[model samples]
Target: MPPGTPFTVVYELDDECALELANKTVHGVCHLGWVPAADGDYELRMAVLVKPNGFLGRLYMAGIKPFRYGLVYPAMTRQWESRWRNRNRSGGARPR
Candidate 1:
């Protein structure tokens, strides 16, 4: 997970199958969460609190939003899906 910069694991609960990461960057702090979906799949959600230093920070966030969602996240999901399918086929062993 390209979890932005300066992130730490804020909370995790394997029993609940949930995890959260808080990222503090120059522009703002973003809290990202991972939770199991109804069908046993996982999903990622994010909440952003922007305290932009100036106009630049706001602009930066706006500029990156499309790139992150349109490109980065889709690619990451594909890779993750591939790995997951491969791992399952291999009986939980990671392929080298």
Candidate 2:
């Protein structure tokens, strides 16, 4: 997604499914526990965080444990989605 665009956390708990995509940006951290296929190993369940720029995304996905992924992910997403529809309105009727 674009800078300052947040996302609301939609936690997935499915078995043997991989590659849950990020909203707009091309890549995202893989929740390792989310099994890629049947009989797959337990990897990791990511909290899906986003950086202001792509650079941070790379640093994060590259296993930068120093940063706190648990805290930042869901918060920003909520903010982004709250503002997203308003920001991209195509002349729709305003809510009463």
Candidate 3:
């Protein structure tokens, strides 16, 4: 992403990464993690943490709750799964 994008990389490691975003209404972190599975594969996990700036921020979060749960999260999961599948097909090594 460009320098001015809302999200900024906080840290990245072999199994996890975090990005932060702050705006007038809210501040948030998006974390993506990978864990070894019992089946000898990796599982992807994601979490979002947010702090509301004030009333507007609280309202904004509430307003987007449905879309976030119903659309955004599912879409993101699909994209990640696709990338993982493609990587395996191409014999790409997992990020470390």
Candidate 4:
């Protein structure tokens, strides 16, 4: 997450971070976690929880579902992956 994004960081820890967003249409929280793998590596996991404000809100969420899945999420994943790859080169700088 960047400075100008709509989401506000609720909390962050070594292995997890939670970001929240609220608007007329919905309130949502996005959680990112790093899970330990059996092979002694870590995998990134994401979960989003949303609450619709009303009928219109529900409709809005439904409408954006396709875009979110087809475009937004994939792009975000790529960006994160790139960041992760460059982290060591950058002296392990934390993601902002």
Q: Write the per-residue lDDT of candidate 3 for residues 1-96, one digit (tens) a residue.
A: 235657788996656778898999999998877777789877778898999999999999999999999998788766765665466567765754
10 residues in a row with least lDDT, candidate 3: 80-89
For each candidate, the alpha-carbon lDDT, in order, equals 0.51, 0.40, 0.79, 0.79
The superposed Cα distance between candidate 4 and the true structure at residue 60, in angstroms, equals 0.8
Give candidate 3's TM-score.
Answer: 0.75
**Candidates' RMSD to native:** 6.6, 12.7, 3.2, 3.2
The count of residue-pair clashes in candidate 2 stands at 11
Residue-by-residue lDDT tens digits, candidate 2, 1-96: 344434323343332212334643234443323323355533223344344337655655556444444545455445433443354376633221
Model 2 error, position 53 (Å): 19
Residue runs of model 3 more than 4 Å from their true location after superposition: 1-5, 80-96
Winner on TM-score between 2 and 3 is 3
Clashes of each: 0, 11, 0, 0
lDDT of 2 at 73: 48
